[model samples]
Target chain A: MKLTKFAMAAALLTSIAFTSCKPKDSEIKANVEAALKADMKMANTVVDVNDGKVTLSGECTDAECKAKCESTAAGVKGVKTPVINNLTVAAPVITTPPPASTATVLDAATQQKVKDGLKDINGVTVDFTADKAVIKGTVTPANRMKIMQILASAKVQSDVSGLMDKK
Target chain B: MALQDKYAQLLSAAQTHGVENLSVAEQNGVLHVSGTAKSTADYDALWALYGQIDPNMASGDLMMNIDVKAAAGAQLKVTTDSTNLNIRSTPSTEGEVVGKAAHDEVVTLVEKTDDSWWKVRTAQGEEGYAYAQYLSPM
Candidate 1:
């Protein structure tokens, strides 16, 4: 009886160790799959997080989506500079308006005000479509003025997006 | 009386346009202007408003109290070309050289003088005069 009890305790300890030793690869793979499944918009993508280093793989719709994925990874706790590969860019196609959770609309006068406000800053592109407002452009370190001018006056309903999209 | 009347008018106009707590008073023909602005660039417009009020403010009896105390509306980034750009006592080199600044640093262009020297901010938030030549809308 004593030998059986000792054997049972040893087996229980071994089982706990085995459970704790799940492969890091599987954990990262599960996380990536979960993210992709949760959001169908993220296609052709793979995410790898190991010891705080993130490697985002796969081609995305545009530079904005690629950047968005990288930023999302960076926001994760302990995440370092994401090694973003397998990403390419194409002209942005507006299939349907970004989800109500992802988009916001400004009234006529306020939208005009934002447009006029953006003109004062250089190296920024602001396009106002009927269904949505898209702001995407590149700002060199030398021309960061454009960043402030855009963010300063940019007022969306909420986190719909700041004034400037670092495209 | 013309300047006073117009200053009052401009102050009222600023309040109407969402510029709050703005006060304008002229003493002995010198315009003592005081208010908060949204950004450093926004104040360039205040001077324009002042110009419409009295164009003679150029090289004339007009003093402005434009304290660049943390603009509330907008965040402006001011950069300097030369590293450790010397901040002197006066606009001239002969004046006492006070401190230094770094490159790509953002600050506020709080004031402008007749000599075209713009009083900008430092990374440490110290207000210093920078030559207008090395500076522009940023």
Candidate 2:
């Protein structure tokens, strides 16, 4: 009976030691989730922990975010090898930039400012025909918005309309 | 209030402790700092890095523009220009004179004390301290 009691006590002690050494599974999950959302700005990732192993999944807005989430999750303690499955990386949004050509009533100086502004971005092909600037180019969403915002800042007298979308 | 207060407290602690080795973290707006510092000035430099702060004071927009050395153990070049150049153990002239450098021998800056003396290393990996005035870029 003493031997059985001793064995039971040892088992209990071993379980306690294991529990203390390993952080709570919920804490690990919360940590992984918070780290990704805070650092990577990923709203789609899901975190799960089982016996100290963490698995993260879901689509991220971009490739940089996906990589950041993986690295950050690995850095947090209590995560033994995170299994990040085939995470879908959505292509960044590409906003169409308005062309600089169409000014209804603008002076030479104003036109020059608009033209100079359009020239700042590389890979942007600007074609002017009939006082209408045909701004054609493919740019990342952020850059596209920045270009449009610059044009708006020019305060041109001309009307900028019908920025084409070719593919 | 808590974040701003925390940053102020940490900044004060850093100044009180030292500034030479300042390591801090600015998350959300609360700046969490640890490690050794060189002086009060170094502590101010660390706070200055927080060019902008978040509304809640939990997020910090740190703009770091430090011109760090290109390589580890990189040789910083220093040239002695003054006619009477003095190599002092500390940044001040009153500091104990440990060694002397030539008129144009460039040395690498290994460490910087709060005072004027800079610990510099040469191309030959020789390390020593010199007055800031007599030293110029190679």
Candidate 3:
């Protein structure tokens, strides 16, 4: 009888030991999720634990993020080795920049457009050089704005240094 | 980027005012800014900011080619300085004067002939090309 009682006690102790050694799958999942939540990059990752095996699934921004997630799940306590990394790396975003403004060439036709624009504004005269229009004469502030607007519309560069502010 | 830094306020304002198709570039010591402002008030405000940044706009370091948004059939006001805006047979001064739009007179835009000229029609049913600078979209 003593021997039988001793065997029963040993059996109960062994069962308790086994229960303490392996955490429940739900407990493993909670622990792994907590570990992943500590990292902002892992926020989007989905953590699933089944029989101590961890499966990570979701979109990672890059390969580095995916690898880090796998390592992170593997390091969690009670997690099985070789965490399943089903995380997909998202495709890189491509943004086409707006077109850059090009330099305006002062050709004869363009210079003529500048001249035609200046015809209505009095007191301003233009001389076309190799690259830019050389503007001279006294102009009221309003007319000065008009002259500049005209030159800009025609895309003609100008040396307005000779222009004087009309009092 | 020095020119860009110098004109950062103006550039930021352009963005804030919702200038469409805004393009900014620096070349040969000059900064070229091109865009279409949403309204005439916004265009004037930008010009005012430009003048404030560069006194008298005499630096010649910036060439801003901003146009106000005006579509065909939009009403335009003749903005001439107390004189009648001459409508011409063609887009240039060489064209014969076809009609006249008085200062502050409202007219309808037929087409944008070019940057410097637009085809406009007055209330009197006369239609021809007029200098775009003298016509402001209402």
**Candidate 2 lDDT, tens digit per residue, A41-154?**
765688778877877777877888778777888888888874555568887789976522222334454455455445435566655555434556665433443344333334
Ranking by lDDT: 3, 2, 1
- The two-chain DockQ for each candidate, comma-separated, is 0.02, 0.01, 0.45
Q: Rank by DockQ, descending?
A: 3, 1, 2
The clash numbers for all candidates, in the given order, read 2, 23, 0
Against the unseen true structure, what C-alpha lDDT does each candidate score? 0.50, 0.51, 0.88
lDDT, candidate 2, B2-120, per-residue tens: 65453565456455655434545444432334443343244334443332232111122221211222233444443322333445555444457566555666566667542234576
Question: Over 4 Å off in model 1, which ranges?
Answer: A1-167, B17-21, B59-61, B71-76, B79-138
Q: Report the C-alpha lDDT of model 3 over B17-36, residue by residue, as the tens digit.
A: 99999999898899999999
What's the true lDDT of residue B35 in model 3? Answer: 97
TM-scores for every candidate against the unseen true structure: 0.28, 0.29, 0.66
Highest lDDT model number: 3
Q: What TM-score does each model's chain B reach against the true chain B?
A: 0.48, 0.37, 0.98
lDDT of 1 by residue, B20-119 (tens): 4565555444444455554445645655665565542322333443323342222334344345455556654444656665555555556664223456
Candidate 1 — what's its lDDT? 0.50
**Model 3: per-residue Cα lDDT at residue B93:** 83
